[model samples]
Target: MAKKPYSNEADYVIVGAGSAGCALAGRLAEAGKQVILIEAGGPDTSIMFKRPGMITMIHSEPKLKKKFDWGYYLSPQEHVNNRRLVATRGKVMGGSGSVNGMIYVRGNKENFDSWEAEGNKGWGYADVLKSYKRMEDWQGPDSELRGKGGPIKVLENPDICDAAKTFIEAGASALGVPVNPDYNGASQDGMHVIQENTSNAIRFSSSRGYLTEQELPTLEVQQRGTVSRVVIEGSRATGVEVIEEGGQRRIVKARTEVILAAGAFGSPQILMLSGIGPAEHLRGHGIDVVADLPVGDNLHDHLFMPMTFAMDNSPHHSSAFYFGKALLKDRFKPGSNFLAHSVFEAGAFLHTSLSQSTAPDMQLFAIPWSYPPFQDDPVRLSPDKRPSLSAFSTLIRPKSRGTVRLASADPLAAPIIDPKLLSEPDDLKVLLEGVEMIRAIMADSAIAKHVKEEYEPGPGYTGDKLRAEVIKRVSTVYHPVGSVRMGVDERAVVDPELKVRGIDGLRVADASIMPTIIGGNTNAPSMMIGDMAGAIVLGTGL
Candidate 1:
């Protein structure tokens, strides 16, 4: 196979084709500028993309390697459960959003406000709110807070089971937590139905939303293309070197800019492969230095420990039930799940310590049933099961940070992902408090009626023993950020405008630019970043 060259130079060469890349490509191409969108994975027009909770089926499909997943795994974590967990990123056009849980959460206002406080001008809640509204087409009652006429569909899942609803109401009432209708509203301090990225029983990934109605005369989307290096010339990113399907390598030049949206892991890997990482790390790999900024330092992700309680009632909490209903061609056809079933999905933000910042240090996601363990084979629990309600505690504002270093200057080689989870003793203390809080919620009379026993770590486990067990079973909640932090400081990789520091014609737009992790799920915030990045790149908004 011969390598293909860019016959015509595009105004914008967007790499990765993930959430941010899709938005950027759509917007830039719509603006009448030539754009080339390259994706490591293939297109996301598969049947599996429509199933709501079919993450397992999607992951198991062998086509994922060729289509929409990078399928990267982390190096061992000394602090975590001593296992190298799988980190599945979409190799498809829509990126990870195509394969993620599809829960749409915008985090808290304080999270964005903190960016402004850190000298990142025009990134506060007030500025990003418009971008959020601009990107979403919400289903429920729209107000000043939610959007009604955007590409992405944000709707509440109506097919949530009766047990799930009872679980939320009972659990929140017992714990004195308010029943908040919208977490994305004025405050993010209550429980409510989870908002999802579904429209008519299909997954509405960035690719679908951004490119559906747009007509781009000069936009070309290439899938099954792997980026090997960012081509820099005289401190300017001019283009990229990539390997196509049959392993043919080519260098495609960009006339204007090369925007990297390869996500937290892929972006850093490309930067390092292009000799634009930490000085010593680059030299160690025998790669000549470019800008030598911290490309992969300050890595962070949301760490979660699942607290499971066996419910007394035999609640219908099975994936079989959900998917079976979807497969059956009864009166309950497509989209009926959203109209009928009511699964209670709610989040709570709390301060582990009174002296902490305004944002909630601990974030909780209450689910009606227990799914299989993270990265487990078969991707389903055994048929012998029980009714359970799980409260997952995520260390929202972690103090400890990690790094993503190259394995051997090889883009194909997996990056060294050391999140340094629980490196700070304070993190453990807060997590411990979260564990206690979940226990208290389950113990409450209203919630207790649904519970039969504690399954994980078992009953009669308390004090340091329980604490140790919590650490033993904890896993990542899939919210990785800050590997390429944004700021005006010397250590920062990108500036407030998301432009790479000390470099021109290059910018990073993804979760990688977050200076710190937000208080809740990162999907909505990441999309917000994509929206803001599009506006910034187009010079349309502040």
Candidate 2:
């Protein structure tokens, strides 16, 4: 598994060493094909990346912007508070998974089936189930729904707080939603324990899980290299132009194909920078248009509104305290009681509106303690401070589509990300229902005894009051997808095989290609796309 130098040519050139990039690189290399992976960020070497609860520490670190984070900000949306939301992307090898909450959600099966219905061939639930199974290594009991041996480790913890347990019971009872043992099992519409990407109390990022030391020889990962644009010849990508350490620009040709696994933002940006996006927009930036396909026109993301509560009893479930103490303990005694640092204990997926034909459109992440926004600071909540619970409701399958357009002609300039959340009135209706649902779950008698007061929106706030509050606080979960959507349509950026609609030797293998966002987290699905892309590149899928 010796590291190999980047040669002048490779069978495949994969951009961005993020979740999908890592998976694609490993899989392509495993097929005995030479692959070169370029990443803008440096290597993932932070101690916080290995610790389960150290996500807070990583978010707070000043070096986050320089090391593992792209630190992009979204344009102000007029629909919400007109407040600009901060979008953090991974700059490191593992990408956002290294900085994320590490939740291993596969989303609802029906979500994929819907893609098939929308003319995206070979992307139905059945087709993706195999990919999911291929990537997972479940630590819990084996079942038809769970995978036993795979790259990513998915596990559940039994040390969750009593508040979390009671919330599940009471919340389900109040809403008549059944309790499900596994969200990935029989059904996705119920309260259940969350499955996390943790292995023995350590965060298992895709870089560590898929590209282990044993697989390095097959994969040549190049870090600290900023990709400028895709090298295209006669509307077909053949290589990439990158800026090396000393600001030296070099072109590396690909013998077979060029794959863009650079996540949602990076993927679409790269395509547009290479003159392969909407002709009108590219022309506005003074760039020559190659294909004029709609590369960044169909952006979508999960918008979340945080519903909070104020409690009256001291609890040991605070995420901040757990992570801080875990870090200190790791410095003193490594591998001693690692379970104490796990962040998410339990979660649920539900249909905010029962009448909708769609599956669960909202997901609830139940945290037993309170922390600052993004959990980016030390535990400031005193031990004597009352414990609280929060239900972060995200609109999973949003119909409102936006775009990522070039802010300038410069390839190094960041793209303008306009998610346009809640542009459709129905989306707002679903969000309002989500807020009401959270209230209903909290009001359940099984856990009502611990409730003290409503912290957000207040008790008197109802109807339009609550709706207004929702619009005021709603923000993105950073799960933007579909900018370079894949489908069998004339306007689609990529075809069913993930090849750019009107181009050859180029494909997008990231969240950007998803015709729509899944019912839950995008990290797992992104990696699965990467795996599928690797197979497609090797001519296995064809």
Candidate 3:
């Protein structure tokens, strides 16, 4: 059969049904608007996407993630021995939120305050807190800070392995901080259970929370609708050109506005494809220049280096066995099914003497299990059972920046992603301190008896050797941002209101627009940006 023509029009044409697109489309539909949410990837109903424990399978097998993962590769990082790393962005409906390790971190309060201090008026913590509340359906304990009764239910991952008990216990004892139950509550400065995007063991992704919860006649979705470019007329973005699943190319017009929620890498790639990037580069690609604002420049992402310790313990069970138990033994229970939620091992944040900032420069991730990332990946340690409890000190505020450039004019071709990790000399120093801090956290006496030995850099590694180990073992925590950064400055791609600079009837609301990477996970904050964008389009005070 010949391909059916795509819908040519909608009041709002939103690109990429990732976290931001789903949230924005839902909000627009709620207000009775015709919205088109186009996704390049497939749906999220498969068995692989549901079971959280299958993450091991989803990760170990590249083919399993290919359907939902963009799976982009980075250019040789000069900092990490010129090694290329895989940057995983979700290609499916729920986007990365559906595939990620459901760690719902709201970032440090100072991260947003820094955004406001950088000339973004409405982006301060006080300004976006209400918007954050509007998007969250938090079911956790009573707290004045966390939102209540909204979409996207938040809960602590109940499937935490027995090793997490040691992680939290040791973290609280060593760091001199209490084992705070709610990290999203009063403050985000202590060791706590990993808050997740699931109510039970079931992953409640943004797509599940916003798009799949209810069907509205106002909202329409075109899965596998790969967008080629935003069709620009004069200075306005009037529509988008896309190649549908069955090799049919069509234009989806926007009557009022066109929004780009295609995430950090994708949003920039689409902009450059539409001739809204560096003029000289667009000419090189034989494309007419629409707006020559620095589109792909100023890219940055959070980096984490882990330190795993071999453990002699076991409380492991097959997910199939637990899923069966959940179906039979614990019927009709809300959070009883351990197989339903992501394996949220435990997490924390720490400070080093090198940083005088109020907010911690180094973030820590303590996991009960470990997968050896490198032979001497001191970051990733393991046991004979490979049941190792690990601590990862993620660099929250990174100074090094990179770029995203078009590899080819073809819409299907992947963009060149160069996240110049640890490019700055100070970045190395901060992370070096972070590694040492994790060693200290693990060295706490409260739970010191169960350890065997430090595998990498055990007795001799020092100074430059230690720094090299930290650099070589580093990998992206899967948080990329700032390619299409927002601000009021000359270099800003979008204004504080998320309006793309030098273009009308076009806006970008996603993690891409963040002026800087937030101190925590980007999923919740990206949804907040989408909610704010909806308010901006409707002329409501955000």
Candidate 4:
């Protein structure tokens, strides 16, 4: 059969050209299947998108956020001081992968094993490991655990600061554990340097790795296009109706499948707009129900409380100064600056007393600067001018869940998002334990030498007061997932193969399909999901 001309149709129509969408489209196209990848945002051609070090700047600057981020705000949480936290999701071509911290964490093996245990067959670590290895082109030395000659290029943080190194050493000393050379490898516990999707001093985003790096004759990318809804006829998804920037709407037919790779929030929003969520909710929105399944339940995310320390008599300058230097260097040298090192270079995954499983419940990030002096959004404040060290204690396995619902039937309107952070008592307990551990690590001899004084969440607070401070300061680590989950039971929106329940030729191939939030940064896993989703659709999945 001859290939169809690139028009308003294709073999596969993937919405959202982000981390997962890019990979899924690339895979299908490489296999000779015509694909159309649609992105709401423009291309990933900005300098801010290319530089590895620009992440800190991106979060700190509101103008940049306006251009790159979805700018969604979670509802005020009753558990965490009623604070309305901002959810920073990428709106660009590469999605969050282009604007995130760039840390590449594959999550714990137990994360996947548990998914399979929950009747989601073939999702165990062993099955997904093949996908991870298949998507990675690691710069690390030869190892069967890691891979080479893959789509995404992975590299270690270059020019790691002295403070980050000391923090890693201090973590090992405080925990009485050896520094694990690779957390993404055999073990996820202990201190280690984080690897990211970066190479040759540039960010290797999913758009760059999969869409731009290779030529796929069968793939077509449509930018500045927002998907309004999945076009369904009876019980089958035929294609999608997309709204262009000029308010023009058109339908792009999908001959085989319509895959939603639009992240956690967007995927659910699109589904509900297409009348495929809870029946009551769809009726309230004036939309007819196609499926009465849970489309937006089980929303969960990681929360981190930052601990900053004043650096006295430090060897390195302020991160702000280095950022400025890098900016100037970019004008002359280009891609040859210290900004290549993502801010949180070294980290540790440790288990708290509250942890029920062997996998660590908390994660700590070491920053070489005084980051966000206040508890508000990092976008509101620039890096402190003074030299400082900061470590963030993150609740990796949060139990609290929330929901995503359609604010209205309007496709342009943002969805209502609520992760209900720290609602579970044990989640707060794990976070408190993480704070204690971070305080201990700061006291270690390796890191104590540079410390001047405890900064924000300052000294003399303990017990109730400390808990209050924790409530006041804890914020999202920008990892939100599990809204449109995959499983075999009642709450599952998608099945083992990521096919939506009660819908034919419709699948979800992004973080939204995760039944349980993985115990690490979700970018890598989302990409793997996209990669393997293509295989599953092609009848080649493990």
TM-scores of the models, in the given order? Answer: 0.92, 0.93, 0.92, 0.97
On TM-score, who's better, 2 or 4?
4
lDDT of 2 by residue, 1-542 (tens): 98655676788888988889888888888888888888888777667777776665555556655456776778877777666777778788898988788778888888899999989878888888888888889888888877788888888765677778887897689888898888887688898887888876677788888886345565677878888899999978899999887888889889888999888899889888899888988898888999888888889888877766765432544545555676677777765654334567777888866337658877888776653433211222222234677777778878788888889977677889888878888888887788787888778888777888877656787888878877877778879888888888866888878888778899888998888788898989988988887777777862
Each prediction's whole-model lDDT (CA) = 0.76, 0.79, 0.79, 0.87
Best by lDDT: 4
User: Using TM-score as the measure, which candidate wins?
Assistant: 4
Which should have the higher lDDT, number 1 or number 2? 2
- Per-residue lDDT tens digits for candidate 4, residues 1-542, read 99543369998999998899998988898888999999999888887888877776667778888877888888888898788888888999889999988889999999999999999888999999999999999998888889899989998776777878888898899888779888889999999898889888788888999988989999998887889999999999999999988898999999999999999999999999999998999999899998898999999999898888887633445556566876898779876656665766888889888889989998988877776755456576755567777888899999999999999999999999988888899888888888899899889998888878887677777898889888988898878899889999999999999999999999999999988889889999989998989899999765
Q: Give the per-residue lDDT of model 1 (tens digit) for 14-119.
A: 8877777887788788788888888888767765665555565566556544445665667776776666766667777788877777878887888888888998
Clashes of each: 16, 0, 4, 0
Task: List ranges where model 3 is wrong by over 4 Å.
Answer: 1-6, 317-338, 375-384, 456-460
User: Tens-digit lDDT track for model 3 on 270-385?
Assistant: 99999998899888888889898889988998887766677655254324444355556334654454457665568887666666777777777766655455532221233334
The list of candidate 1 runs beyond 4 A from truth reads: 1-8, 60-68, 312-332, 337-344, 373-384
Shift of residue 176 alpha carbon in model 2, Å? 0.7
